[model samples]
Target: MWGSAGIVKPGLERINRLLSFLGHPQRNYLSIQITGTNGKGSTAVLLHNLLNAGGFRPGLFTSPHLVSPEERIRVSGRVYPGQLEKEVRDLGKRFLRRHPSFRKDPPTFFELVTGLALKHFSEEGVEVAVLETGLGGRLDAVTASEPRIVVLTTVSLDHQEFLGANLEEILLEKVAPDRGGCLVAGEVPQYLIRLILMRKRKVGGDLFTTGRDLFVWRNGKGSFDFSVRGEIIEGVSPVKGTGFQAGNALLALAAFSCVAGSVSGKRGERLLKVLEETVIPGRFEVVPGHTTVVLDVGHNLEAVKAFCREAGKLECRGRRVLVFSLMKNRDPLSLLRTWGEVADDIIYVELGEMFHPFRRIREVSSLLGVKVLVAKSLRDALSRGKKIAGSGGCVMVVGSHYLVGEYYRLEGKTADI
Candidate 1:
């Protein structure tokens, strides 16, 4: 499923069927469902950590694994063991035996994995689950979980082919699972917040929005304070310290404050500790060496723009080199132009079979205003980037999660972040 270049059917029919067969294990625990273009994984991880600090025994499920699928499903910040993984597979086999219709028409890979996560969470006696939607919330498999807390991170122009052509249309599809649950929205435009309230009135829930109900102010470099629900928690910091990550942390903290009621005393201390220690892999993850290397999986225009902003903050003695490749579905013109402003040179490489054509990138290469070079492979790209960056500069590998996974595989490193 990770390697396959196929799209799943857009609806809850298949996942609903699977959940019904499994006796709806999702209802056994409180769930927090997250959906967005960029910050879904980070928010999920943050909320999961907060819930774990509250003694919820939380299970987390996120998509586009960096190196392995095991990174997707976790219990109490640890991957579900291999033995239980086999047990879930056996249970899936039993489901196949019980339902003959599924033989002719099988559920998608994401559906099967979501079912596995839900069932495993139930069997492991998890009290809460944090689920990040694999795609749009209306049709994604995770929506069948019917989460109690719905978190919408910054929704940008991503997966437009499946979600919608415009922002309003995509917003509706992404907010479909909010069935009278506590909805926490990130820093979106005021008009969209009004649209959200208009759509959510049918299924009522108290909406806590950033910049209105929730606010954050910088306390120091890489540290800030969150003011939510008329309470202010001070001296909180996020991993990587990017402006976008602080926004992501604000969304997570807002949702956590909504669920836990108060972010103070022992609970507040535990949550703050979790935030300080949490490290999300492939989100501006820096590996120190003679030439510092940074890995990020920001492919879309909005996400890439955030990455470029963060990259500009890094102090480099030499030139900053960008190592990048994108999926075929993305338009590289805007992303290349954005990267060109921050990076001194760009090395384009093939993302195995999923590589986007170089001709489109070449057509706009002149407009980038930076040197763009093609490499034989990801390894070659990284090597050339390091050489170009020299010993005193930085080499940033960004664009897609597939590229980061390839790097981890080559280095024999586990992406347990």
Candidate 2:
């Protein structure tokens, strides 16, 4: 069903056909659909945690698992049991046997996984499920669930080739799943906000936005306070990424308020307590040791800019070294320049066969027009970064999630960091 590893086919026909044949398990429970350029995964995860804390069984479906494929479909932040996998696989076989035509044209990887998650959520009796789109919103497989509430995180230029060239076009593609429940958005340009408002009006949906409907501010210690319609929840999030994460947390809170009622007083405090302890892997994850190492999956320009901003806020005693790699299609020069602005030294490495056909390290170094270190492997890159960082220095691994996963696998470390 997959033509290439990263190629995206945006439509609903394939997934709809498959789900229809599978008894429409997505219809059994309520859903919240999240889609945007970035922070969708974090928002889904945070929302899952909050809902689970509030005594609800919420299933979460996200993409690009850090370690295991089972990470894509989680119940209460844990992978589903082996029986679910067996059930899904057996169901798929039965479906193909009943409809021989499907054997020739099977569902795509993401579509199959999404179907499995929906079935698992239904069988497990989850009250609600959080679905993060694999690609743009309009035709993503998650849209097949027809979510009641939709949250649009920070929208920026990332998948331009598939989505659009400009913000307006991209917004149009991402906002197509809006079916008029509650549309919660992060801080975006006024024009994009107007477009969202227009969509809300068309769908007859309520709109809540950061700095307007909902407000979040970070304190000196990096903990955040969330305010919505005069009700303030103090010390909401302790997740230390960029300031953008505060906005993501607010989006999650706003979404929770939409489905589960307003968050205030004791309930708000409980949610904050859960948020205070939540740590999303590969999003500014800091590993403590003799030399500090940071792992982040900030691939796009906006995400990388946020990473740079957060890196500048670190209280490092020595130089800030960056270890980076990117897929072949990504714009490396722009990301490299953004990292160069905050990093004292940069090391480029080959991600090997897993992320093969990657951009050559020498070509990237040549484009930067600077003396950048090139490593043969991720382990070598980490070693070189630590040496360059010296004592009390900081080393940052960024650009792509694949790079971070490779590092974890090579170092025999868990992706749960």
Candidate 3:
């Protein structure tokens, strides 16, 4: 939501009302609610994959689909059938029609989608649902379910306009899920970590941190090991990016371990199998071709830094080229400076004018004091980036999810992996 212009009414009353009218489908299944500025989607997907591999019928609810709205909801890594989705939408409309109050004060788009996902999960008889918060944790529609386990991935300074301007305020708003039971967090700053501990203590929740309670370290190529409460899991991570992904994997494993009890050697082996097979789209995904193409949805500064760090690790034969854009509110110059440190050339492309009000290419180029190639469209940008990279080099598409989504739309790619 930070990358787009949307009125974020941060309150749970609307979603609560909608869920109550829909028969509280969320209560019918166990759930894990994940929240953070970044890494929540990847963490949620990883947890979903773990549950599915562990013989549990898991439903996943994520956000900002790369191609279609249906990508937001899935059962066992598969989108719900079109007929099922249509039925749920019709049911939601019928409920709204019957309840004039909802019609008068309409639920937000996210609220409606949350309800639909919960309903579908319930109807599909899922054993557990992994819900990634659409925005800040406290008032996010997903919070209405009161999940059994809560996972907080790295809390950075994004969505400040809606959450807060500073780290303390943002951390406070995002720690709403630290109510009770097990609360797992990534290796965030010490100050934020203290805030999380304080909040968890206030709510009588047990906290498991990446470096403190859970330990994870890279073992070898594409492999990492994690230890929690005297139990250790050595596995190969499918996510190919900065070390941040290993932390994300540990967070997911710790959360699932807490929910499913200790991770035995056999279970750890199963988790590793799932981790090696799972691939999340738009998170440093490598598309095979003559020139390596990496795609990621990293709009914020922290995310951009991670993307660049990971891209630098790739074995590029030629120059590294970048195709990028960001929303109007973000500091495009800072992003450019970070990317410039790793990229040999940059091609700035304008995204959609409505939701994605991307920064002007000329403005960003001037601020950075660097000559950047301006493309008339995403297609042109890709062509130019590939041409610059040549057959031996690599081209990375980064900055906003909108940019990555546009690329997928142009390429007619609907698969998430």
Candidate 4:
């Protein structure tokens, strides 16, 4: 639904209708609903791992799949087959036939997918389902499921066209799904922290914010330690990403600690084991080979900055090349400037007419600090980037998720690792 050019009809009405028709499968399992400008996918995966370790049959649903639509739904950390999606589609068609009013006003693609995931989870006998909101909190389809724990990861200025124009407005839109439940918030901008707390106060939920109610810090040697109230889980293996991931890990751990009630002995061991094993694809994911490659689906300015910062941390023997393409609506000037500071070479590929034109980039390429080069396609860009990087260097693919999806499709890669 994210990569498509479909207009977002933000509301719970359609999804609610679909869920009701499906017999409210979401009610059959405990759930954690996560929403944020960034890190939602990674956090959802982490929480799913924790739930698995806690001996629950966890179902994870993330958005903007890298390779297949089925990637959006996973039971016990494994994606459903394409046929399952087909079955869900056929079921929807059958329902529409019975209710001509539904045919007159059909559910959106995301709503259908959300219904599919919930129904699948119910059929799979999931004990808990971790759902990452497809959009802002309140109106997103995932909200229809009604999670017991609601998590808000780092909130930033993105999706202004739909969410809001400024951070405060966007924060309101994100915190609307609190439902006066176990609301956990990650490290948001300092200014928004107070606003989130204020919202929690008004909404009357048990507010748990990182650095306030919960704390996580590096324990040296690429390990982390987190504490909630008085309990502590020490020596958690670092997540496979930039330093920012520690915050995401902490957010997940905090939410899981609430669900599981304690993180000690066997439970602590499970947490540690899951942390070391989980590798979220397209989130600063590194694939090692002749020429090292990094894939990241960071569309907004904050995400781009984090991607560049992580790319800078890599030990590159030769050139550090960046291959990227941004949506037409995004202002690439600042993003380009940030990446230019670290990248030795930058290659721009045109995905379609929907993306920002390479010619538009060429117009201000001189003004930008990076050495910009245009490629005929993603394959061409990756090839040039690998050549520029040589065997000893690195090629980092960043910007939109669509760009990363395009690369995976062209290269026949499922983004394992």
| Model 4 quality (TM-score) | 0.94
Residues 210-316 of candidate 3: C-alpha lDDT, one tens digit per residue: 77888888887666777876688765665643454777788888888877887767888888777776678888888878998889998888888888787778889
Across 1-417, the per-residue lDDT of candidate 4 in tens digits comes to 221324578988778878888899999988889999989998998888888878888999988788887888898778886674566567678668766686656777778888889999999999889999989988999998888889999788888888999999998888887788898988787889988777778778688887788888877767778787567888776465346577788888888877888877778888877777778888888888788988899888888888777777798898889898988888888888887888889999888877899888776577764569999788899999999999889999888788888878987887432
Best of the two (1, 2) by TM-score = 1
By summed lDDT, the worst window of 10 consecutive residues in model 3 runs over 1-10
| Candidate 1 global CA lDDT score | 0.82
RMSD of 1: 2.2
Instruction: Name the regions of candidate 2 deviating beyond 4 angstroms.
Output: 1-7, 83-93, 219-222, 240-244, 353-360
Model 4 CA lDDT for position 90: 79
RMSD of each: 2.2, 2.4, 2.7, 2.2
Q: What lDDT score is found at residue 353 in candidate 3?
A: 59
Clashes of each: 0, 0, 0, 0
Clash count, candidate 1: 0
lDDT of 4: 0.82
Identify the runs in model 3 with alpha carbons over 4 angstroms from their true place. Answer: 1-7, 83-92, 220-222, 240-244, 355-359
